[model samples]
Target: MHVTELLKDWPCTVTGGRPRVQVTGVTERAANVGEGFLFVARKGKRQDGASYIEEAIQKGAVAIVVDRPSLSELPLNVPIITVPDCRKFLSYASARLAGNPSERLTVVAVTGTNGKTTVTHFIGQLLQGLGIRCAVIGTIGIFIEGRRMEYDCPEMTTLPAEYLHPLLAYCESRGVTHVILEASSIGLANSRLAHCEIDVGLLLNIGQDHYEEHGGREAYIAAKGRLLHQAHAIIVNQDDTQCRQMADASERPTLYFGAAAMLGYSTDLILQKLAIPGHYNRLNAIAAASALIALGYTVDDVADQISMLALPEGRLQRLEQDGVQVFIDYAHTPDALEAVLQTLSTICYGKLITVFGCGGERDKGKRAEMGELAVRYSSLVFITTDNPRNEDPVRIVRDIKEGFGGDCSTVEAVLDRKDAIRQAIFRAAPGDIVLIAGKGHEKYQQTATGVLPFSDVAEAEWALSEKTYEGKVEGGSR
Candidate 1:
């Protein structure tokens, strides 16, 4: 695409030579610039992309889009496009450069504090079951036509437009008719999903998270509200007052889904039979079902699909051996941990054991709340590390210990995650349930040194196998 054509609908002032340059790519990172590429120099929170303009030009960026006026001072002969908000413009320009593939496909975005991944997965599976080729973009990774793509970036739940638009174009080329994406609050606040045309927007639920990033709870909720503006039709969880407010704010058609909706409508009873454990999943099913229904599917058409839907990996994933059941979940927040533990407490036959910790440099306030919730719901608690990046792991544990309201006998602090899992499994008796919280589906543990390979499920399984092997050896010897 020519430089002029890329900026056709974009609101920007063009300076320098108006060369008819054919742009081959778009990127914010100067290192990724190649021949005939457009380098976007936008100011970020910590660093400014404008600082890398010279490097991008050296690496063959044909044109530049910059937000800062001073950046145009460089005596580069290439065309410089100046915009008020380069990050916002990047989304539109990227979509235009990628042929606006989202315009050709039905896109559904799921947003909330929790259940975004699971709900998006559910919608994708339902669309696939109905013979529609679909793609999913969210925390787990990108999925196109029932296959997981190699694109994995844990830093952000939603991909930036520079990457997201190209991925959508690729999906379109593969004949994907539908796409489901997780719309995260931070991503929306950063205008990541600005240009994508959303057919249906689903808000699962909202809670205390990313508080530091958004400044406060109100700002966080406002960021999530951006999804409603971009979407054509909105589906919200009525149980949550904030979600209800979001639904009210939508000028487009809206639908509501929750336990109350399920009870009020007889046909929605299929939500109760979801194969995934927990009432939260039932609500997610309703949200997914509501989205499909808005897309013109009936309850009967998708009821069976909902009943047979598989839970997303690491979402209350269960492993049972020798009468001890272990559940691995991505419950890092206070609300998420409480929900998972509360559900397990009711079904657990013996004791409910929880192993969890908070991530470093995140919302530290939630650490103590999670600790308190763990102790309130679990028979035994093991507070361990969960990606203590840069910060001292011991300090993070101490912050969590404050929530315990003085040391309790049931709560034990274990710094080593492997030992924590091992102790939890080895000490479990028959009919006990062990809940491994935080760092679900993540195969690595981030520390000050670097990312180290770690898997909660793998560690738990190894511990169980070791215990079983030890028991067999002792019995044979006796």
Candidate 2:
């Protein structure tokens, strides 16, 4: 494509000469620049891309797109296309350059503070059960035509415009009929999903999260509502007050899914017979079922798939060891923590031992709330470190303890996560339920320094194994 063709709607001027520049590719990162590529100089949190323009040109970039009109430092020969927001233009230019592959497949985007991953997984599973070929992009990673690709990308949380065509192209090659994605508030705010056509959008529930990045609850809700406006049909949780408002704002055809309505398809989205247990999960299930139904599946088809659906790995997953029940959930947010703890409270006739921690560098406001919920519900609360990235575990523990109102006999601080889990297991007796909250199926613990390989399921299994092995050895001696 010629430089003139790509700069449509973008303010550009050929300063030195009107040389016909034919660029083969486009990139926001200077490192990715190759022969005939157009490098976009974007201002990011870490560094400014304008600083790397010399390097990009050295690598044979034919054109450059930037927020500024002219730079004294930059070469006058290269065409500069100035835009008010380069990030917004990045999505459009990248999509056009990549051949607009998203138009070829039915794309369903799911966004919320919680249940986005679970709902996406459930939707993919339900579609698979209905014999439809579908692909999913979320916390678990991308699924293409039933095959799991192990590559991890931030695009899973926020669909980047750069990878949009590549993913759609991959799905197209694999014969995938539908694509399901978990769109985060950050992704929506940053214009990641701007160019992509969302066929259907599912809003699970809104909660106070990512306030630091989204500014406040209102801004976060507005960012999530962006998807609602773009979707052809919006499926929402009627039980959520914010969701009700979001549904009303959307011009698209809307469907309601919740446990409050026994008449809806979500009436039994979360059943007692499932491997995972939670009323909140029931809401997630119903939302997913309604999404599938809107995608053209019959009521029976939706129910069969949803009923047979199992919780993905560690999202509200449960295990039984020596008459003790252990529930592992990915509840990082305060709402998630409260929901999981409340569910365990109902199921555990004996006692609910909660082992939870807050992540560092995230929404710090939720720490105290999580602490309060843990104290209120659990028979025993263990406050521990959970990916305290760059933040002192002691300080994080103190913030959580603050929520306990100073006389916290029920809560104990343990900075080491593994030790916390160990102590929770040791403290629990027969018929007790141990709730391992946060870092559900994730294989690594993210710290401010680095990522330490970790998995809650693996740790729980090892603990269970050690106990069983000890029991067998004692029995053998007896």
Candidate 3:
């Protein structure tokens, strides 16, 4: 595409580069620049992107776009285009380049600390069962019409605009009617979902999961609240005060679910037949039903078939066993970890054995909190490693031990995740439920050195199959 075409609404001038250069691809990172690519020098939170201009030019970046339009330091013969906000411009430019696919289909974006994946999954299931063709973009993977699409991008859940718009375009081309996706707090604050025309936005519940990343809970809430502004209609949690306030302030056509309601369906009708466990999942179902109702489906149309909604993989997933039960769930946050433990505590006939760990390089504040929660619910707790990416496993375990407050009777530190899982499962007897948390559906383990192949369900199954190698995990995959 021509530079003239890409910078349609934004202010630009040819300056010293070619009068009409074509941009074969676009990127914010200078290291990813290749021949004929347009390098966008975005000013990030930690690093100044303008510093990499020479590096991008060295890698054959044909054109450059930046919010800071200064040519005194930059070399001559390169197009220097300016935009008011390069982060927002990146999303809009990618959308325009991808033929504006979000406008062609209904977009339902879900934002929350814990239930974003589950709510998105339930919405797709309900809408698809109602005869609407649907596609899902989430942490598990991208699926279009029930088929997972192949992707290699920087982000796993909320992708950057360059990768996101094209996938939305492909879903549009494949005859999809609705696109459901999970929007993270950091992703929304950075403007990744800026230009997408969201038809219905679901606010599951705001929790203090990324306090360190956003600086505090208020900033995090404000960041995720950006979705409410972009949405035409909102379906929010009436039971949560923060979510209710955010949705009410938007003043858009809003619907409510959970406990109270302006216009919502009763969850009891579906909970009677709902196969998925946990009280949180009951709320996820109501939120999914409300979102579809806002998209023109009647309440009666959604609730009847919503009982068939299955839990997303890695979320309270069950594994096969004879004497004891085992589960694998992706509950990394404090709120999520507590919720899963609380749910399992109710069904546990004998003892609840839990193995969980915190991800390094993230909000360190939640590590100790999760430690306390795990000990409060489980009879035995193994504080293991979960994605220790470039951080010392010993130091991470020490941080989690702080939550025990000098009483380590219930908590034990096992830096090796696989060993911790094996010990927990081996110790379980009849009527006991063993839970492997934190890295549920993840297939890799990131230590201080590097990433290695790992899977909780596979490890747990192997451990369980050892007790009696004939048993296999049945109906576990999503």
Candidate 4:
């Protein structure tokens, strides 16, 4: 495409020269620039892209798009386009460059603190079951028709606009009729999903999370509420007060989903049969059902299919051996942890042993709250390390211990995550349910050194295998 065509819709003034250039690609990172690529120099939180203009030019960046006012330091040899907001411009420009694939398909965006991944997956399952080809993009990585599309883990829940537009274009080529995406608060706040057209937006429950990034609860809620205004129709969890406020504030038509009837919105689907456990999961089912219904699917049409849909990996994933049931869940927040443990408390025939830890560099306030929940709910609480990225593992464990209020009898701080899982499984008796919280479905553990291959489900299976091997050895000796 010509440089003038890409900037035609974008608000910008081109200077340097009017020489027409054929742009093959667009990128923000100077290292990713190639021949005939348009390099966008936008100011970031940590580093400024403008600092790498020389590097981008060195790599054959044919044209430059910058938001910075001072372009005196930049090379004036190439066509320079100046815009007020480069990030917003990049979103629309990249979409245009990628052929605006999102506009060609029905895109449904799911957003919230928790349940974004699961709810997105549920929506995909519902769509695929109805013989509609669809794709999903979220924390579990991209998926096409229930198959893993990418082997590597995504760095964030939502892909950046530069990559996202192209991915949607690829999905369109593959005959995907609908696209279900997990829209994160940071993604919305950063304008990652600004260009993508959303047909139905699902807002699950919002709780205290990413406090450091958003500053406080109000800012976090406001950031999440951005989805409400972007989509044509919004589906929200009426049970969540913040979500309710978003629904009420939005001018778009809204659909409510939850156990309780709010404003005469019936939640008859909550009582339907579901393979997944927990009341929270029931709420997720309602959210997914409501999204499909908003898209014109009948309740009865998807009711039977709902029971066959599997829960997303690492979400209350159960592994059973010798009457010991081990459940691996990605419950990193205090509210999520409480809901998972509370659900298990009702089903536990014996004791509920919990092994969990807080991630480093995140909201420190949730550490003690999670600790208190574990101690109050579980019979035995094992505090261990969970991706203490660039932070002291011992210090993270100490912060979690503080939440116990000095009740160290039931709480044991085991810095090693594997040992924590081993302790829980090795000590479990018949009918006891061992809950492994945090880092569910995650294949690697991030630390100060680097990310190491780790899986909670894999560790639990190994521990169970060792126990079975030990039983065989002892019995054979006798």
Clashes of each: 0, 2, 0, 0
Per-residue alpha-carbon lDDT of candidate 4 for residues 213-248, written as tens digits (9 for 90 to 100): 888878888888989999998888877887888789
Model 3 agreement with the true structure over 1-478: per-residue lDDT tens digits: 8888777677655556674777777789888888877778887778977888889889988877777756423664677776777888788888887888999989999998889999898889888888888999988999776677786665378889888898888888888989999999988998999999999888888886878788888899999899988888887888889998998779687777884342545666666667777888877877887787788788678767776898888989998567789999998988888889989999899899999888888888888888888888999998889999988888788888788784578777888888898888878887899999998889999876788999999889877866532344333322
TM-score winner, 3 or 4:
4
Give the per-residue lDDT digits (tens) of candidate 1, residues 1-478: 8888777776778888666899898888887789989999887888889789889988999888888888766678788888888888888878888889999899999999999999999898888888889999988888886688885344468999988988898888888989999999989998889999999998888898889889988899999999988899888887899888877877987777787673235445676557777888888877888888889887877786877788888999899888899999999998899989989998998999999999998889899899889999988999999999999999999999889885889999999999999899888988999999998888999999999999999998887776653356321111
Tens-digit per-residue lDDT, 1-478, candidate 2 = 7877777666555444244778687889888889998788998887999899889989988877777765523655677766777888888877778777788889999999998888888888889887888998877778765567865345257667777656776787878888998899988998888888889898888997898777887899999999988888788888889899988988888888777552264364345434446778777777777787788777676766655777776787888877878888889898888888887787788989999898887788988888888898988998888889899888888888878775578888887888888778767777899999988878888887799888888777666655533345321211
Q: Report, for every candidate in turn, its global Cα lDDT versus the true structure.
A: 0.86, 0.80, 0.83, 0.86
Output the better candidate (1/2) by lDDT: 1
State the local distance difference test value for candidate 2: 0.80
Error of 2 at 84 (Å): 2.2
